[model samples]
Every structure is written in C-alpha cells, then in structure tokens.
Target: MPDTTRARIQQEAARLFVKSGYHGVSMREVAEAVGVTKPALYHHYADKEALFLAMLEGTLAGLSRLVQAANSQVGIRLQLDTLVYELLASAPEQRVGLQLASELRHVSPERRAAFEQEYRRVWVGGLSRLFEDAAARGELRGDLPPAMLARAFLAITYPLVTGAPTSDPQGTARALLAVFLDGATPRQGAA
Candidate 1:
C-alpha cells in the first residue's frame, strides 16, 4: 500500500479516536473518514484495536525520538522549552496519545502489559534518562530525585499539550518551565 493512504487512515483514525472514545468509533467510520472502503481500512489495519495500538505506539516512539534528538543539543532549558512548544503545536497527536493511556482497557489483556511497557520505555524511560543526564551535569535541581523531577515535569506539561488552550505557546512554555524549574516566585533581580 502507498504511504499517503496508510497515513491518511492513521490520521483520520487518530482524529476519530480522540474525538470519540475507543469503543465509540468503528472501522467503517474510519474508512469513511479516510475516503476509503471498509476493506481498504482492513488492508491497513486488522481491526480497530490494532489501529489504535499502532497510533499509540507511533506517537510514543515519535516522542522518544524527539526527546532523544533534543537532548543531544545544548541548553536544557531551551530543550524543555522547544519540547513544550512542539507538543502544544501537535495538539491532535497529543490528545490521541493521552486518550490512549486512559482507554488501554480496550486493548486485549494478552497485549496490554506489553503495550504499556512499550509506552513507558519510549515516553517515560526516554525522558527519565534525559533528566538523569541533566542531574549528573548539575543542571537540574538536586533536591528532588531526577526520576521524580522528570515525572513532575511531565505532569506539569502534559495538560498544556493535551487539552489546554494557549494563545501564546511560547509564553505558556516559558511560564511552565519557570514554574517547573524555579517555582512561582520571581527570580532575584527581576522586576
């Protein structure tokens, strides 16, 4: 199959899944959304569960690669800022990703643990390593464990990307980073 057709199906499915819960949407709806026949959708994905799993995995794997790439560059603050901004910009994908976390029960029990592990490995695991690296370099606050700090950082930023509205993504990123790094107080020598 061609890349565009497959990509369109995935994109449309992600949209539908995000808008409607896992069980709410059907393969027929996905096919109609993608302007393809039901059989064509099946050619791309065995079933709705398979399609959802693929979307979730793709999102996590993409995030892992993104963070790893960002970590290689200098300036941890800039890295975090860039990451937050990018995540907010990709609202659809982020929504789909978060929705998958809540709706994983729809996944088969046999595959559930493996899928969750994959999600952790790509998303949490990658970010945890980045935080660990920052801690080793004395770039992160030493009060909290690097793992805890990473989780906190994600918790703080997750809402911003998942569903929060932002007129200014950069400003929002700056505020979030400041809060995550420095708490709510104004830094010394600031107005």
Candidate 2:
C-alpha cells in the first residue's frame, strides 16, 4: 500500500540519517535504502529536508505521547519506570532523533528554533511539571528548581536511550532511577 511505502521510506530515511549524518547522506541513498526510486521518494517527501523534518516530528510526537502517558500515572516511581521503559523500547527511533537533534545546526535557523522549542515544551516542560508535583509531595531529594531537576533527569537518561551499551534496559532504568532519587550514598538502613 502507499501508506506502507511511505512509512518504510520514513524509517529507512531515519536510519540512514542517523548512520551517515544529515549532510553526509543523499536523497538517492535514502531512496535506495528504502528500496524506492528517487522519484518515488520525492513523491512521498518534497525534498531531503522535508523528509528529515517529518522523521524528526514523528519521533518527537511519539516521545511526547509516551511522556504524557507516563505523566498520567500516580506515583513518581511508576512514572519514571514507565517513561524509561517506553523510551528504551523505542531506542532505535530515539537514536535517530538524537542524531538529528545533534545535527540541528545544519537545518535552517527558523526550523531549528521551532523544533528546539517544541522539544523543550514537550520533554522538558512535561518533566518539570512532574518534578514540581513530586517536590511538592516531598518525593524528590532536594529543593532544586523543577526545571533544573528535569534537565538533570534528561541528561541522566539521554545516553541510555541514545546509544549506551545496555544489555538490560529495564534493569538499567530501575538502577538509574534509584541513583537519581536516592543519590550516590546509601540510605541509613540495613544493607
């Protein structure tokens, strides 16, 4: 079907873009990777920029939905667990997003700015709200600003979702959350 071909083109383009940076990969390469002709690819997306932007948008939208779902959960632990698991479950796509994100400098300034703003609004803003609620309930460690806490959480989890070598995503997510919530030092209790 046409829809299936379009989706395949998107997926292949994302993988190629991640593997060979945006500037390095050609539209022909993407078409070949997708087993489509250049004209067919153009029919799906006007240009490489259009295709790349579409890929980025899809990745961000998926992540936003995941974070929103996690946010609906009651407890901080459950929220973090669900967020991490869902993110890692889509690690391949997330890596493509991460790759494109790092290469945003190559995109037009206006487009880059818009993408950055939406990304922050979705990921950072969502996390900040969650952290704020947790802090209010004494669920967080210290009095750090919710925005800062959100950024820290993102930094901690970035590599995990991107390309970090992790044999066990679920276990890694749990350990990372524990270290995030409890800090490096153990609590005053039986070992």
Candidate 3:
C-alpha cells in the first residue's frame, strides 16, 4: 500500500521480467527479489498477470507521452527525429516493452488483444497523424498514404530497438531515420 512498497515491487518485477520472460518469473521469485513476502506482493498485485500488465501499462504510458510530445512540436522532421531518439535511447529495462510486444501473442487472448489495441491507438495512430501533418505541410512526400508510411517507419526501427546492442544506438537511429527520410522526401524535379 505504501509508495515505497509499490515502487520496489515495480522496480524488481521489471528487472526480473526483462531478465526472464513474463512466464519465466514466479511470484515467489519476485517476492525474494523485492525482499517482501509472497503475501505482501500479492497484496499489491492480484496475480502475476496483473503485475505484468502494470509494468506494461507504465512502459506504454511513458512511450505514448514521448510520442505525443514529439508530435506536438513545430516541425515534422524534428518530431520524427525525436521519436527515433526516444526509442533508441530507451534503457535496457525499458527495452522489455519491445520484447513484451513480440511475446504478447503468447499471453491470454484478452490481454493480447488489449495490448495490441492500445499499441495501435497510441503509437500507430499517433504516427499516422504525424505523417499526415507533415505531408500537408509539404514536409514529407505526399505520394504515400500516411498510415502506410507510418507502418513502414515503425517496421524499419522496431528491430533495432528490440535487439541491437546499445553501443551505438544513436548512430543506428540516425541511419534508420536517414533511410526513411530519404525515401519519404520528394526530390526537386523527380516525378
């Protein structure tokens, strides 16, 4: 119930979840990691599924805010660059969001659907709007549909976030951005 207990549980559970997949860790292991009894952990979270969802919700909330903030900025190029950096700069713990995303199919149908819906609503929908706005302003090529282009951009960068080493995340991010932008930008005279 206390703030510290809740924070500790989230911190420990996130660590264990990243190190071991959601199905791999048990309540007892989380309890030991947090220095709390199983009953204490249960008091805060009804079950492992509940705790996993909480961690997932928190990660998505952070990412959604980041994307929304970038979208609100003045320029589309800046907005895209900001999103790239945010995704690339995510810490190892936050990287679990990508892993969990891939593993969501293994979760219960209800939770899996819910996760996918929220992901689309937040990340995909936001990206579509950004591309549309950019195209309207002549900041991006107008030939491609915003929704399709948004999906393409996400497809290009998701792998780097999920599996690439952190040694040069920024560099990888720049290259990915360059590739997408180069294709999306209209040339001066090309039809």
Question: What are the lDDT figures for the candidates, one per model?
Answer: 0.81, 0.85, 0.81
Best by lDDT: 2
Ranking by TM-score: 2, 1, 3
CA shift of 84, model 1, Å: 1.4
RMSD of each: 2.1, 2.0, 3.1
Instruction: Give each model a TM-score.
Output: 0.88, 0.89, 0.85
Q: Which model, 1 or 2, shows the larger lDDT?
A: 2
Q: Give the clash count for model 3.
A: 0
Off by over 4 Å in 1: 186-191
Query: Model 2: residues >4 Å from true position, as ranges?
Result: none
Worst 10 residues of 3 by lDDT: 98-107
- For candidate 1, the C-alpha RMSD (Å) to the true structure equals 2.1
TM-score of 1: 0.88
The sequence of per-residue lDDT tens digits that candidate 2 reaches over residues 27-143 is 899888988889988998899888888888887898889888898898888898889888887887788788887877888889889988998998889889888888788888556
Q: Tens digits of per-residue lDDT for model 3 on 119-159?
A: 78888888998999899999888999999998898888777
